[model samples]
Target chain A: MRNLIDILDLTTSEIDELVAVANDIIESPQKYAHKCAGKKLATLFFEPSTRTRLSFEAAMYELGGNVLGFSEAQSSSSAKGESVADTVKVVGYYADIIAMRHPKEGAPLVASMNAGIPVINAGDGGHNHPTQTLTDLLTINREKGRFDNLTVGFCGDLKFGRTVHSLIGALSRYKNVKFVLISPKELTLPEYIIKEVIEKNNIEFVETTNLEEVMGQLDILYMTRVQRERFFNEQDYIRLKDSYILTPEKLENAKEDMCILHPLPRVNEIAVAVDNDKRAKYFEQAKNGKYIRMALILKLLEVE
Target chain B: MTISPIENGIVLDHITAGKGMELYKALGLAELDCLVAVINNAYSIKMPGGRKDIIKIDAEIELNLDIIGYFDPGITVNVIKNGVNTKLPKIDPPKEIKNLIKCKNPRCITSVEQELPHIFKLTDSENKVYRCIYCESKAK
Candidate 1:
């Protein structure tokens, strides 16, 4: 009956359990191959996405589940003006679970309310991406072997980056976690996030325009692309697009073990030259998304 | 400068000074043919600096108490019967608001569908922040 709409919907213990299950799936892929046998996953992607959609489809296939639904609104009855609430109610009858990615934030939330089955928000505008948060958690847990006492640096856009907001909210639950927010003045972390998550939670955090100065201090460098889609003004996006481009030269000051992550479909934010670097783990992070999603599908389906 | 009391109607007392007109508009007092007196700045001991807004409507219309409460907690609704305050209904703040305020998020489905109700869930009551249930956008 529960849906993964926001990262905060999952508690600390629940998140740990999910991470544990994800690790288990990674350890023994064959054991969970048929865990979701005969179940159906309706991926109602109203927006164009490659990684998130593929990850869900691939995860379901690995779990021995069937996949259904449209890739975009144009392909579905939505193009003819069928409402999301009505569409989900009908789809809920066909699918055991739904993984939806909509350009409009809260579309999945409306589905969760109307649908008979569990609804997963793959990505919702710039609001929240819980599954990505789960993927990030699994990646962090595997790479660092811990969440507590880590200096996490978030580079580039934080104001409109839902991943940064979700990850910061997730990590704030752990102990001794300090955040180093690196972005231009326009793209700096929102004051609401600073007030609600950082100040209210009493988590230590510092804001800066420089990423290199604090590179050595971080255990994890969470990189974010300046999202052109989230911005209302193309000029503003163009002006701030190259705010932080992670090159090998930028890694000179970073610690040897500091892992870098991006919810991919990355632009020029992270240089291709850094891909070979031992510290770069964004691709690995993307791969982890499938495993975590597999675990999430299992949890929501009660296949575990 | 006292407005005459109504014999059989409702009186909204102790609204936050500048917010009376907003509530008035939200409650749709425009279409009503009844005598609606809006006191934009009225003296009250309860409010800070002894100033508040009051609304007196000469009709027994059902009030959207939840919206009123969510809009401003200090507002009290008094029902007058036979020139006396016969009842004081408690306005419980609505935990979830549906279609009252539009989700301003351009990327919200509510913005596109146009037919979908603008739903908001009260996330933080103490800070009085309501988030759009659909897009998670904070209510302005």
Candidate 2:
């Protein structure tokens, strides 16, 4: 009866259970190697994404499950004008479970309605990415020891970053979490998020243009890319691109134990100089992505 | 007061007066050259406290005939042939519907530029929104 479409769908206890399962998998990888043996995971990436698609495939393979599905719409019946509903009806017959990534905002929810098996939304168009939020949760729990009473700084494109929105939605459920939002004025978090999620819950959060000023106070500095394409004026991007960068000089002011995380394929928002720093856990975060996905696949299929 | 009859027409009667105008606008009938006989505030009766407004539309647009049942099933349709009224029995919404309208979410797969059929189930007719049974996205 459960589908992993959005972070809010998972209760705090369920999140804790998933993180516990992921941690267990990390410790004893061999025991759960075949948790999904003889099962099929259909990765229906309607839009092309090399990173997320490959991660889902790797997760299924590591769980001893076979992966089948298209990486692009052109490669599937979508090219032949088949509808999402009919596609799910057909794909459900073949795969035990489905992991879908679509350019459309609500395609996965559509698929879930008709799919007899569970559906996982890998990513939807500026909508949500719940599994990534799970990965972040696991990483924070392991590193920081708890979700409550922590000050987390979110940097770069907070406006359109579905990950940030999902993470905030998930984190708001916890107790005493403070947010330090660092972004260009243009890329500030959307009002629906501010009114509907943040301020509505009375979670203490402050917006700032200066990243270094708040570096020392953060428990986790979540970095997101500031793409040139998201900018209307080139000069505005030029002025703000360096505003959110996490460099060695920047980390000098940051607490030595402060964790730096990024949903990968990151541009220069976090400088290469900071990669060697002990606090940089983005690559580790990427690896954790696979394990958490393994946990999600097993949980959704009710395999173990 | 009664208006002159057309040689052949369909009369939608007992529509809650103002609602006939809404149905007329929804069907874009104002620009048409067809004879539209709108009799508003022409009927009144004591129902405990006060009376109600009612109107009639005399035309043969079959789609509009179907729409009358959709908008307000209380209205009755009578096919008038040279002033002879032949009452057509009422119709109601189907118990089960496969698809209704395309979802409004731009990123919804239904909005994608493909020949795929867009389908929706009426979730809330009052709000005029449909819940895409696939995406679960509310489309207005």
Candidate 3:
């Protein structure tokens, strides 16, 4: 009956439990192969998101559950003018769970409210992507082996990056964690987030425009792309698109074990050469997306 | 000018000056068939400016105290019966407001779903911060 519309919906203890389950699934994939053999998952994607949609499908398939529903609004009843509530309510009749992504923020919340089955917000516009935050958390836990006392640096478009906001909100819950927000003045982290999440939690943080200068101090470098879709003006998007390119030269000043992470769909913000560095874990982060999703599916479905 | 007292109605006293019309609109008092008097800039020693607004409803209609409290908590509610004060209602900022104001965030689901009621939940009571339930956009 529970739904994940926001990252804050999951408590730190529950997150720890999910991470534990994810690690267990990684260690023993076959043990969970048929856990959901008789279940069905409906992915009602009102917007196109290949990676997230594929991850959810793969997670369900790996758990022996059937995947149904459309990949885009045009392919679904939504193209015919069906409301999200009616669509999900009808889908709930066939599916035991729903994972929805919509271009409009809070669309999954609407689905969750109306649907009889549990709903997972795969991605909701620029508002919230709890699963991505979960993926990032699993990656952080695996990389640093702990969530406490790590100095995390968020570089690039902090303003529109929901992942950065969600991750910062998630990480702020742990003790002794400090944040280094590195972004252009125009795209700095939103003031509301800084006030509500950072300052409210009494977490230490420093804002900087220079990523390289603070590179060595970070235990985790979370880089985000300046999304063209989030901007209204094409000229502004073009001006900020290449704001930070994580070249290997920049890694020279970073810690030997400093983890480099990006919520994929990168557009030149991260240089291709840096992918070879041992610090690069964005690909691994993508793989972790599936495992954590599998763990989330199991949890929400109440499967052992 | 003298405003007559209602026999069986509610009186909202000591509203911040100039907020009478806003409270009247928010409370939908214009739609009421009964007499509703809005007296603005009335002299008041308690108010910081020594002036206040008073609303007198000449009917025994249910009032949404939360809305009134949100508009001005200092305002006192007096229930009169037979032209004598019978009861006093307490007020506080509402925990959740529905359909009172529309969510201005264009990305909010409520924007596209015409049937969805615009809902805001009080996230920070001390700061008087109300955020849209759907998109978490702070209310202005």
Candidate 4:
């Protein structure tokens, strides 16, 4: 069975296929509505989530599939110290697929290893959130129309933004994609990603703390929240919380078509006024998440 | 000082100088009941520094060659039976290792799930980079 623990788990062709399926679902929602009518999706969330859990439920519901599982660890058997493997193994019997989210990294992978059913990693700590990457990919594709030859600027906390890392890893596979990393030095992109994903791929990239300096050059401005949960110390979190804020003034120099994207629950990183901007696509991104997830479910379940 | 040759055992030769104790500790040779001799800074014509370390085991015990290969593939292994030496093929770094090293990342699933085996996959063989399969954290 196919499981998506990381964005790299899907090849470029597979990703294209998913995007195509997602677009088709968007075009004619009723055509694929009954595709997974008899299937059940088990959303085993061991951590708190708002959009992701709801998106998975909405996706499954739209596909005519039944949704069953907990929204948090306390609501599930995990609160009683049940292992991810055991929980998924038991759930596999009842559900045809699983969507898991956990605070600990690789919990879904552990689930996938034991789960007889296909598993999708909804989110896992700050390590990976491949579905979010897919959402961003769909947003970019719909807004910009192509993944190649775009100057993508990743602003704010690149260090703890699993979405940014996953998106960068995904985009590096494309041709002529230049990355403009804008973040404070303390919250810069991890060295391993720069060395392994960007440098190894020979992708052009420039790192800077100033967002405005490179704002005009970007075709896609991917803003990320400086997550307070990812910090070990309150002082560090407070110090970096307001590092980058996307506002109307910041968009002055940006291209008219520069698509702004964010994985929601954004905190104060994105200004409320920017939401009115035509270039703002974060809401659309969230909507796209449901459709892509529907496509992913259909693909994993091998439904016609 | 001359050490008595083992009648039937294994000889680990050409270990990088100063890594004999590390290899011994890694292999848990200190816990072994059989006689084990570690010769440090032994003159070697093949080694770059003209010095190497050699380990002689007095009993036929199973050795994890992957650990040895991860340490240094240049190190040679020899099986001695009835005072005759039989050199084995050169060791290669293992594609995957389990329970050898713990994932140091605090957020890694293995850290909380004590029952989960600490597994690492060789992601970059050229750099000998082994990363935890769970969190992709580099094995230090």
Query: TM-score for the first chain of model 2?
Result: 0.98
Error of 1 at A120 (Å): 0.6
lDDT of 4 by residue, A190-294 (tens): 998999999999999999988888989999999987666767789987776665888899889999999999988877899999999999999999999999999
Of models 2 and 4, which has the larger TM-score? 4
Answer with 2 or 4, whichever has the higher lDDT.
4
Query: Given candidate 3, what's the lDDT at residue B71?
Result: 73
TM-scores for every predicted model? 0.91, 0.76, 0.96, 0.95
Each prediction's Cα lDDT score? 0.90, 0.81, 0.92, 0.92
What does candidate 2's lDDT look like per residue over A266-285, in tens digits? 87787898889999999998
- What is the docking quality class of candidate 4? high
For DockQ, the strongest prediction is 4
lDDT of 4 at B125: 89
* Candidate with the larger TM-score of 1 and 3: 3
Candidate numbers, best lDDT first, in rank order: 4, 3, 1, 2
Tens-digit lDDT track for model 3 on A1-304? Answer: 7888898999999999999999999999999999999899999888999889999999999999999988889999888878899999999999999999999888999999999999999999989999999999999999999999899999998998899999999999999999999987778999999999999999999999888899999999999876667677898877766657889888899999999999998878899999899999999999999999999999999898
lDDT by residue for model 1 (B1-140), tens = 97887999998988888889999999999889999999987888889978999999998898878789788776888888888896566666789988888888888888888877888888887888899877777999
Error of 2 at A206 (Å): 0.7
Best by lDDT: 4
Query: Candidate 2 chain A — worst ten consecutive residues by lDDT sum?
Result: A191-200
RMSD of each: 2.9, 7.0, 1.7, 2.1
Pairs clashing within candidate 1: A106-B134
Q: Which stretches of candidate 1 lie over 4 Å from their true place?
A: A227-243, B1-4, B16-21, B29-36, B39-52, B58-61, B81-93
